[model samples]
Target chain A: MARQLYELCGTDPARVFSPFCWRSRFALAHKGLDFESIPWRFTETERLAFAKHDKVPVLVDGARVVPDSFAIARYLDEAYPERPSLMHGRAHAYRFIQSWTGTVFHAALIRLIVSDVPPLLDEKARSYFIESRQQRFGMKLAEVTRDREARLPEFRAMLSPLRDAVLAQPFLGGDAPDYADHVVMGAFMWARGTSPLRLLAEDDPVWSWRERLLDAYGGIARATPRAEA
Target chain B: MARQLYELCGTDPARVFSPFCWRSRFALAHKGLDFESIPWRFTETERLAFAKHDKVPVLVDGARVVPDSFAIARYLDEAYPERPSLMHGRAHAYRFIQSWTGTVFHAALIRLIVSDVPPLLDEKARSYFIESRQQRFGMKLAEVTRDREARLPEFRAMLSPLRDAVLAQPFLGGDAPDYADHVVMGAFMWARGTSPLRLLAEDDPVWSWRERLLDAYGGIARATPRAEA
Candidate 1:
């Protein structure tokens, strides 16, 4: 069987937006591997039953199946040892970054861009997204992102760790992109693919770091379809 | 000359409390090196002039002086390459954790424990600490930490990343404690040295992790005198 990655997308198959999927995408690119992108939607749980996981970015590499992004990265490193390493045999060290991204970065980001996402989803996925997200936030999607423009400063202030890290080095992995970079850049990719709002200032060190990552891997991330022009 | 570490303390020489100092102290211990702890008060900037930095954690080896905790960790790794690897020769990969500890962890922690610190300081150090911290907070020390007990939940909430990471593993660096563990454990040491407040619930995963670290290296951290009974 050909190697394949099931990725999350919306109306347009090219618009892959899930942050977790983006991590796997970047990981695959970093490993210099080729895989067909199979666009998966929000309500596609049964479709992933073969992997026994209800998440996108599931990797089907030959007979081996990897279900999570971190697991996918580890699988790639283990399978392709000669290729560039993602976690450098220290997958456990990357957990803190993953935790921070999942809890802090993604929590803050969803509040800023959740309302902007439904328009890009097909009707069935859009309904599922809105209902699930509204229940999660305890309010309507629009209410969750209300005053987001005014909250941008607070959101940006919360990014001090990322800003400080990138200011000291070109990437979170330091001098080059690694799984840590992929984890963080995945969030930015979500914002880019869904929200047209300017999440970062042009002069921000994070902006520069994201630019470098966008240009890395032969501008693969940069060339991905974004909501913004 | 014998290796020496200049660490921040207050009225008692044994009450080494600066978070950064704890990092270097832990780093040194991790490397199995012995150093005399020279307690330096807050007002003693002149004492660190040889290192050309006004930091509490300055390592003076036989012929070299290293200032800054992160730099000291790097120095230890370089000076003793055969010792247990702290950053695993990927010191840059550790920057994000350092940044998080410095900005998010430290910033939130100070607000919770800053007021408790003055009583432990000598008069000159106490005055300097008061003035500097008050100026930084734009309020009196007590006012800065007013209603701190009521704010414990929010303060704990800010530690989600650390909590999540430790929940999944024995330490931030995986099976063994590395520089990342030291960097974060340093902050807890500062709180332990200065505050009687119960920062973590006994059942919290972070509390268990802290207990592990406190007992890790011959109970070095646990043996240190704490403000709490």
Candidate 2:
């Protein structure tokens, strides 16, 4: 899936950066695979724009449209099996990370939604953010608005398990980055890159992993088109 | 994991049957596998009970404990790869089903929580239901009264995509039942067996699937023992 998507639209005819596209692009680069990231954007009125889901992180591989970061990450593991495995040997741990990345990161990402500066966060950003949040948290955003202030402590505490793991090993899987590391890092990167979530990494070893990973991907990354629905 | 949990429990002990356990038990039968159901009364004091998550349909396979209908069903698929693949050939469809079972059913399950028998209602159950709503809507139980009235329409709409697929095949996958069917049916069975949800099944093919599956599981269907955390 990753290979197919990469084969199609992952490359840029002219290279500029798209951070959302950087998730897969980084994964590919992490595996040292050759691929291109064709950055795509949208204006509210553009019918054929890549942001059909109104999200930046869609991957179009050949004819296949892969949406959602979890799906793209899984595609990377399956398509590039011979390259370093994201899962490595710990299947249960891998599944745990996958579940966490898909669900739990919403809190971190929400901080990004309120931010300004990203060119993508234009006039439609507020409406688009609400729509995406609705699709994700349901039409009721308040349902998800757990007191971020109160919950931050507990949420911050939860990362200790991962921090302990990363501190023990160079990567989440030990010695090398695995699926757990990449997926978690991809989420952490996005959250940190675009939102107040960057504060999460302050004075933490997890931040080191993030910095090294982004650096390995050649610093700032580009966006890829959201896969066609 | 299913076999492992079954073996660990000895399957000889418990005798209470709730709608949730039946889903997992029924799936085993549909696949022609043998197992035991130890009935559990979901209560706050029972740390091992589905009450922990304010949900039923928890399955125990050997020493390993699997929570969430989707996780348990998928674990079963992984543990027993033979028989038939529960997820059809389309990966996205299987994922779509899994996601619905996880997310949409979560909303639907909230309705059943409020509608169950009075004797079965416990502190944990009440807290989870009310708190989830409060957290989501900032409203109290007085605001969103019954489960059926509040969430059934949304539940039915969500199931529409799978309606035809379920009818064309004896199970969600094909002529044979698979993990997808079990996960979905298990969740539905919980509702059908317990609350007012049984009446709502008449209009949908999913209801028929539930009936057919429960009938197949027959005598072997018993309550799973309350788990200890």
Candidate 3:
């Protein structure tokens, strides 16, 4: 079978938004690999039963099936040693950044953009998303982001590590983009595809870094449909 | 000239405590190199005029004068490539962790331990430390840490990234400690050398991780003279 990747998307299949899925998408582009994008949606666990995984961003390359974005990146590196490395055989070294993105970055981001996501989903997925996230936050989505504009400074302050790293180098992986960059840029892609919030100031170095990634790899991320113009 | 590392210390020269200095010390130990410890005090800027830099951890490696902990790590790896790799030829990849340690980890730690540091310094250094730190925080050192006990939970919560990474692997560099581990453990060493504060609870995963580092490299960190028992 042709190489295939199951990516999470919204009602419009072109609106691929999940941060985890974006990591895999960027990894594929970085390795110069082509794959068929299988648009997966929320509340579609049954659809992923074949992979024994409920999440999207599942990679099925020939006889191999990788379920997680990190796994996919590792698999790509191992399977295609000739391609540019994602983790540079130091996969564990990237864990700190991944942990920061998952726990800290995503936590702050969801508070700012959670209310903006439901409208992009289908009725069933919308209901599921709202219910699950509301239970998680113990509050309505609107209330979670009630003072998001004022909270922007706090959120931005939380990004000091990322800002400092990118300011010192062109990418988190150093002179060029690496899996670390992909992991962080994935969060930005989530905000871009689902929310029109100006999460970053135009003068911020992070804004320039994101702009570089958007235009990278034949403008793959740039071509993706977003909620904003 | 014999290899020498000018490390920051307090009244007692053996009580080397600067976080950046510990990074170079740990990096040196990891590389299996030996060096004479040249104790540097807080008010000893003029003493380092030879390096054209005003900082502790100025590594004098033969004819090469390298200042800064990160630069020292890179210099060690480049000069002694056959010994072991610190950055594994991905020095840039390590920037994110260093930035996190410098900006986030160090920032939170100082607030909790600032008051504990003054007593460790000499009269001159203590005067300089109190005045400088007070200016930076816009409050007296003791006032800055007045409610530190109540803020323990907040401080611990900030370590989610480090805790999660260690829980997933034996070290930040996976099965072995790397420059990343050295960078973070350096901070804990700072606390150990200057504060009586129980920064990490005995049962916390981070506590265990710190214990492992304390015992690593032939118990060099463990053998160090700390303020705590």
DockQ of each two-chain model? 0.92, 0.04, 0.95
Model 2 regions more than 4 Å off: A1-20, A36-81, A84-188, A197-229, B1-23, B36-111, B118-148, B151-185, B198-229
Cα lDDT of model 1 by residue, A34-130, tens digit: 9999999999999999999998889999999999999999999999999999999999999999999999999999999999999999999999999
Candidate 3 stretches with Cα past 4 Å from truth are none
Error of 3 at A184 (Å): 0.2
The residue pairs in collision within model 3 are: none
Q: Is the docking of candidate 3 incorrect, acceptable, medium or high quality?
A: high
Q: Which sequence of candidate numbers ranks them by DockQ, best first?
A: 3, 1, 2
Cα lDDT tens digits for candidate 1, B10-31: 7999999999999998999999
* Comparison by TM-score, 1 against 3, better one: 3
RMSD from true fold, candidate 3:
0.9
lDDT of each: 0.94, 0.49, 0.93
Best by DockQ: 3
